[model samples]
Target: MTDADAQTAPDADVTQLEELSVTANRVDGPQAAVGSAISSISGEELEQRQIRVVSDVLRELPGVAVNRTGPAGAATAVRIRGSEANQTLVIVDGIRVNDPGTSGEFDFANLLNLEVERVDVLRGPQSALYGSDAIGGVINIVTRKGEPGPPRFRASIEGGSFKTMTGTASVSGGTEAYDFLFAGQGFSTRGVSTASRFDAVVPTRSLDHDGYKSGTGLAKVSVRPTEALEFTGVARYTEFDADRDGFGATSDGYPFAAAVDNRDTEKGKQFFGRAQAKATLLGGAWDHILGLSYTNQDRRSFAGTDLKTYASLGEMTRFDYQTNVRFETQGALPASHVLTFGADHTRDAVKSFTAFPFPADAPNPLRKHIDNAALVGQYQIGFFEKLFVTGSVRRDFNDRFEEATTYRFASAYTFDQTKTKIRGSWGTGVKNPTTFELFGFSGNYVPNSDLKPERGEGWDVGVDQPIWDDRIVIDATYFQQRVRDLISSETVPDPGDPTGFVNRPINLAGTSKIDGVELGLTLKPINGLTLRSAYTFTDGQDATGATLVRRPTHIASFNANYAFLDDRANVNLGVIYNGRQRDLAYDAATFARTSVPLKAYTLISLAASYKLHQNAEIYGRVENLFDKNYEEVLTYNTPGRTAYGGLKVSF
Candidate 1:
């Protein structure tokens, strides 16, 4: 899940245990066949770890860094392999959910675990299949699809420290011809003060605690009237309202920019939908798929009574088509060849208004739109049923300023003697500047309409070894990446308004380098007991050789799960360690930004669940066991130790 999750040895053949991945390739295939780094977390792991938000478990993942500005519902950003947060792509089912209005990044703060069947994380440059914003990697969330069975229902509710409460309900059913599922979830919490007491700008050490509330709904349907034809579709919607802290106070007070405490809140609504049709032809030798996806998001921020201090709306419409051809022969030493190709077009539009300190002078009045189309092709060959190789290329056409080409090559070879797999991948990627950076947010933030897109290239090599009859697994990988034309913010004097200065995005003169090592181990030492651990070392720097902000150099995690009492009771424990990091701090008195050191810290959590009956269960967990005082972002206070308990029932 987080890394290499532990699982008991299966009754089936150990060497045959294979996990499927869809994000690495356009189509579903065995993870071991991808020749790239990938990991998966099942729904069972979500319930076992008592995880409500996806970010809570991402810290244990290799090559990933999670940063939350303050409390549970605060602004959360995830970076993969030392890349920028916006470089990663977030996908829900077949739809892309990255908001086009907010720097082209998906905020993990409002994501809830509702009807999630599996989460797959792909670590590599993937522009060959996915067009843009995938320079770093991809996070794919797969939802539950109904199977042929009787109707089923499930419900759960929990309450815990900090006046937190959560509830979820779901109903699913299906028949031979059609299947459907519907689910909903809700969460609310009274969080801790977002501003740190150590900050000089804080009005007082004891300020009102920030709070958050959210709700989400999901629906899915599928139809299969004939063996050669099928149709499927899904829709999801989410809404959230969260309290936030203000930037540091300005000279005249009322910080337009935050370590100062204030009653500021943010609200957002997002909706995504996708529909697809698949057909099989030529006696299963040819497969075709056509799909359409839509995304809409509206976000607003309120400063005290001013409900529309800042607001934005983003929308995207996409059409995709793909085909696959296969040629294979049945034999003792079989060899096969497959060819895959696809084309996609997307239209992205955004509009925003900012009414901060200068209501009239601000409130940017421009609406922007961008169009992009891409063609991708891939070829795969497998010989002796043990070695697989894949190569892909893509060309993009954009109405914006940037049009580029990307390439990727990968291979995986397995040895029958030791059941060990050696894998490697190399890829090139490109990311266009977001609308926000291109057009600007407010007058105080100047636009960079002439800015160029960021370009990158990377490579990785790894090995996966299973020993002790699949009871133990060890995985290790090494990766290196280089990025050119990096974008960063710089303060510049406003030629129009001589006395004031504004921040603008600029392309750095040189390249940035990032390299990392990932190691994971999982063991099922005994029946019903499992242990897992992972470690990551990353070295990231700008052209000037300064450590990248918030990129920790060392990280390690350990988790153990035990089932006893004839499998009626289960418990899990997790320990996470984050090495020192560098973060920018704004001096309250001088208002100058300076890079500051953040001490290393560790976090521990424990969860236990017991079955009360065949259809009922009770569970509880303790988070931040030591009440560790630390900060993921400078001046943002993190929550202390907290506890919660809940009951779940299913039929």
Candidate 2:
């Protein structure tokens, strides 16, 4: 479909969202018919922009913040609409990928855009449709599917500064009854120093280059045994290793003192698989789907010098089963009344081992597990063919915490004559505490089994207007969220040792608030030229009236793309700006917290591609074009100017 058609289409599903289609409701419909703020990026567009990492791709999105600890392959956190890193839910190919062992947060540093085809970002609470950990929003990643044409194979290789190298290969094809797709990718880089440079009174280790390497593979297969039944399966795996620095005390009193001869290393692996079966019944008016999914993650870290050694290992396993049913009305007001119901069960378990005090002794292996079941239902109706409304509810039962119920209501109205649409939504969400929060370590942390779940209520209203015969689109939205029973670490008296104190998790009585306004504009002034821009203003504060750390008050981005030579060549340019933010610093000796101001910075990027032949292409990209010196986190070093070039061939 043409860009204009894709942008204006009213009825779009998950597959169409990346093509400029929007669907507010999970059951599927036109974006104009659902009441929620949503955004999406197509895989084709991402490839054109030379966005290789998941963190880089999400940096400029509205109402989103990406904080990286260091350069590439370092720990990265994504916050949505002022929510904490663990409050947002991330789904890959219909499976949740959050690491249960790490406060239930997903690290974007290791997620590469290798076989991804589309990304749908739904802003606002989504607990009613997606159970726990969806208090902020939901991110859905869809992978490429085989095409019903001759088999195709493609490969590409690239190298750049920092001794970075990358290679990718893929094969896909489909027939009348069967289809399959397989892809593999590998990347390696001799990264820069992860720690910032600081003067030290005592001699310290010389600046050493950290390095990272990763390999990933994906496979998918689908079959249609009969006219009424279909089956599909998917599998994915990734392994990575990275070198890191250590934190030590310096004579200057800075807590983030560089360790001499640091030789820390981290290794991790992830695997996920899913199988699904779908059936159509009652003359295609009713549909049923059943799916089973499994995920496993392992992480190991080694730190310290020759005389002393510290190591830790963490592993997590998850199993999930889900079934869904949808019914279509036989009679309607020129529109269908869709009803959907689903249930799911999930079990998560973790095992961890660690050695403390310079390889002297090892602590007992820690093991924990949690399970939850949820039932969800949704109803959608259209009246007079111009107004639509939807309501959804979910009931969840957790093995460790109290049961919870979440609900959402939304509506949309369209003025076809003026090409204007108004939409609004209200919802409630919840997040259960992680295992580590409930049960602490051997010596450092204390357990808090009495902790309650974090609760949130939020709402949003927005409008979409089309101008210049739908060639230009404008969107504006306002949203607010209040969170109760905020969880935080607090110093408490140690029961086992009356003379000592320890850090323990506690639920605060006061509430935290987050509110924001988002604005976006898209213009297609010419057939081969496109321009887009987005801006967000956020106000995030704690109950004590203190600004949240690492959250910028203002964020904006502008992008332009132009194609020439009969669509054989294209150039893309983009700029991102982040405003000053408030943060905190702790004293090395006293451990006293002090407020700090983080300066703002802007970055520019450029990418270009040219078709060498009917089945081959050449591409190149420049990141941080001006080599702007900035840090997303204090005491962390960021990458400077970098460039890469690659060639791709398809048959």
Candidate 3:
């Protein structure tokens, strides 16, 4: 049997509900005793929303923002609670894909949407469960696996304004002992004409040449030799290319740099396999999950230039192998007291290359290696019929960095026979500076070897209640966080340089703080109508009373769907609103405005779907219904109204 079949089969002896989870060691409910805030999105919603990239789907959540340089396959990054991009962790099937050498974070432009089965966003501090790169949160992408019997296939094609075109296909098949799945996606866009919104004029020399292209593929296979043992393997690859203008101060300001290739491209491959066994002893049973995951990445980047646009290319390569062994007690102390233990190890080899347009022997590249090891333990206990608590700790040691320890504590209380629940959790998070931040070339930029691990602490308190005969669910939560030893560049006068400039990392200000409240509601008033809404209010600042840049203070969203003509067809509509934010200045004379106050705009989207057959459905959507004009940045513009329609067939 495949993983999906195995998941559906539960032991008749167990009395607990089959819990599905990715953030915790134990698969359980969200309200279960744990130290993190986890959220999930299903494949159906992914298809309904027509989300082509991971960042687009994540932006629907509270306190999260995505910034794209331009177009679909351009450089993209995410910000959470005012934290930098690299502060968040991106994982695929328990395998880490973060580059150890660059502060550049993972861009979803390279992912194939057809292969994604589910997404889990685990928020808050996760250093105890994962290691570095978990200060802000963790995003886990789980791909589709096996098909039941005969070969299954699906294909979709869509086109819209700005010459955008997208296509995706997937095929799967299997027998009783083995199964396989493969999927691929390709997309291209002409991009928005920046000249239309700027103060420059040209005949076909438009800044709109910022087009993009990307491709992705995924494959998975699983085999089972016996009822008690099974094996699974998965691999995926992606590449993206973009042509954009350089990051110059102004469109006509001295032409600081020319547009070299301006290609932001990356390729990554991952393979992971797992073996599991089951047995029974002493009226209790043991289920083992042992696995190994390896991943590799290659990245190339360039900056636009003065005449014909020179290129500055940077490349990073990483190799990781980890073994995870987990054991849990089946009937420990009446199923109320459960314990879990696991160990992990990883080794990484890194190399970085940079080429300038004018220099042939500027500086040699750098090579380094990193290794990490950790051991963790967690315990969950139910003190009484209405009270529960969980605690966990982990010690991590890295070869190139100092050792550190992280921990978490959480508690939950049930009142009125579990009709109402209150939970709170506190944890610590840590992150190591990427290799580029520590060992890059030193001309105008300098690397700091004295840097220490950035640390953070936070807690979340929430209440969940069911009302109106369980037809309505309401949840409210408040969170707060504080981080220390933040790294930033400090400029000083250069004695021998012509323009006099030198930059180095400094542990500026002692602490940065963020606090917010999130409210969520789910209501099913009639039989066929459902409504969901969420709102988040956030405040972020440092000891100096200056607001952290790029973090908006208010975000709100609502979605409503009503089934028409018998539950076989339906229409869904949604609206999202984001408030303005303050922009920070990197230099003295370059402050273009007192504030980059983004205008508030509402995006309206409509989706309609009808089932053509028992296993086939066709859907269409009109996004940005009003063609609203907006900007997430100072000069960059977002896409206008667009329409798409597709069909989905599952068997």
Candidate 4:
């Protein structure tokens, strides 16, 4: 289902509360019927809040944490329920976008909300449906498609602090025979300094402003020649350039202190394309779908005085083909049953190049490739018409590792009299080692070809209830996960030298455990007014009983939106609170690891919009309304009290 099918709240209107979600089970169905922890944000809500980056939108989500190296366009990491950044799978238009060459991690800083219609975050293990790298969760981003109406056009422009500016344009329309949509966006900003001095004792560094620029484009088309057959195609591309700080440069160490000016820049390009066909047979009881997808990514980092003397390049390409079949019987056992099965094959390859010193000969580029195949099956059964149970299994074969099998079971029960539901799910997940982890760089890392895949088992139980004439909805979930063979780097004595040490990746002998509780409340006290609040409490520990790094113990957010003046104007307010956390920093002088405590911080934002005509509107927003000084990462600068205004025209 599309984002326009339902309101902001999951249970805003009890009669029309069945919002279809495909991320939970890889099939379209009511979100409430799925026995898992899930949440979504619509494009309309994102526009109202004036949010442009995907990372900003995810900070308020339950069971999620965001850490950035600096301000806008900087490297950003997203952690779900205390899991590692690479453990969560990121999917865009049904294709995995994680970078295979970089520890299988997806950087959220580059994911702009240009033509996105909806974002669904599914918490906990989902390997039975999505395969590897789903040990933590899945983030599915659905792009906008044509609407079934007259052709529409839209344009928007905005400017904010730090010399930031953005512009976007889109066109979408649909007919009985064909539908299409196209969108483009451009963004640029002169951001704050990525690194801070901390104290006067530190060596002097260039106080230059980091700059970022990006362009994004999306196109989608669908055609239906017959009533039972359809075809769809999608393409997306993004190009970005960012000025960044030197690596390993902190108060303790300044590698470029002698240089008068640092010229460090990072450039990247990403592209994805997919084509699919669907057909119905056996009098509509059987449905079949075939899909093919391709992805390509290239990144380059430049450093030194000339900005080209020293450089590194990383590239990745992947191709996948999948087929799925769904069968429904007229008369099933007990009540009714829907059976689904699918198989997919994927090939991925990576190449890297690096030049150590100025004008030095580039090392021989490293290239690697791997193949994967998987088969999956799922069955959903309904008993007494109110209780639903789903069971799924998957088997995966990897060229570099051992074969693995995963399974999941989930159930949901609804009480018609009280409009309450109870749901629970248990699942197993796996994450294979990435190319970077298995093969070391030129001289920095040590390769370990025998590294094992990380494995996890997790479960969650939750309740959803509606009260006050269905105007208020509340949900609470408790979840726990245990992971084995956790991957980490250790300093080991070099094989060639007696006194030298090298960092090597290895699997930890002990297991890591993470558990959390999530609570959500939605209120629609009156017409044109809505409020939402969510709270999360997470506790994570390794085998050594030390808290995990960068995982907050508590997080909470509250948002309110109201419209008045004959629906011509609206106001939005949001407040977010992040609890204290811990991280480890390396002391260059002493060559020791030190635990650092980060202070807690809160942020408040306000937005308002007014309609000037039927097809035009103006909007303004203030971020960090309180001008609070906070740091999500140590020695990184955060923007304070930024204001922006924009105009949108639609036809």
Among the numbered candidates, top TM-score falls to 1
Please report the candidate that would top lDDT against the real structure.
Answer: 1
Write candidate 3's Cα lDDT for 1-651 as tens digits.
Answer: 012211222211000112333544333323444434555665656766667777777766655666665556655777665566777777764456665545635666566576676766666777776767777777776777777799988777777767778888888999888888988888888876432232222223344456777777777877877655557666666666665543323335422221222322333332333333333233343344555555556554444322322212223222222222323335534336656566667665555665531123434566655567877777776644456677878788877778899987877776766568787888888887666676654335656767777888888888877788767878777899788877766766654555655666766568888899877777889998878787778898865667776677887888887887787898888888877777533333231224346666788898888988877888888888999887655455567888877776766
Query: With candidate 1 superimposed using the best TM-score fit, by how many Å does residue 292's alpha carbon deviate from the native?
Result: 1.0
User: Model 2 over residues 558-620: C-alpha lDDT tens digits?
Assistant: 889898999999999989998898766644433344668889989999999999998999999
lDDT of 4: 0.76
TM-score of each: 0.93, 0.92, 0.85, 0.92
**What is the C-alpha local distance difference test score of each model?**
0.80, 0.76, 0.62, 0.76
RMSD of each: 4.1, 4.3, 5.2, 4.0
lDDT of 1 by residue, 1-651 (tens): 000010110111112125533445555444445687876667777778888888777787778888999888888998889889989888887788888887898889988788777666678888887768888888777778777799899999999999999999999999988999999999999988887542244455457789999999999988988988888888999999888877755333432234557788889999999888878889878878888889999988887746678788889889888887888867797878878888888888888888753324544655888899888889888887678889999999999865799998988888999989898999988888888888746635667888898888899999988999989988899999888888877776666666666677888878999999998888999999988888989999987788899989998989898999998999999999999999886544334456788889999999999999989999999999999999898767899999999999999
TM-score of 3: 0.85
Model 3 regions more than 4 Å off: 1-20, 25-31, 193-205, 251-284, 302-335, 357-363, 383-386, 416-418, 441-444, 585-595, 649-651
Candidate 4 lDDT tens digits, 1-651: 111111111321112234533345565444444777787777777877778888787887789999988878988999888889999988787667778767787888888888787777888998998788888898877778898889999999999899999999999999988899999999999987776652224445457787899999999998999888878888899999998766443454453221122447888888877777777677656666777777777777777334442223334333333333444345455565667777777776777666642113323466777788888888877665578788989998899888999998888888889979898999999998887677535444566778999999999999888899879989899999899998977766666667655566889888999999998888999999989888999999876677888899999998898989998999999999999999766544322356678899999999999999999999999999999998887667778899998999999
Query: Cα deviation in Å at residue 86, candidate 2?
Result: 0.4
Task: Give the lDDT of residue 563 in candidate 1.
Answer: 92
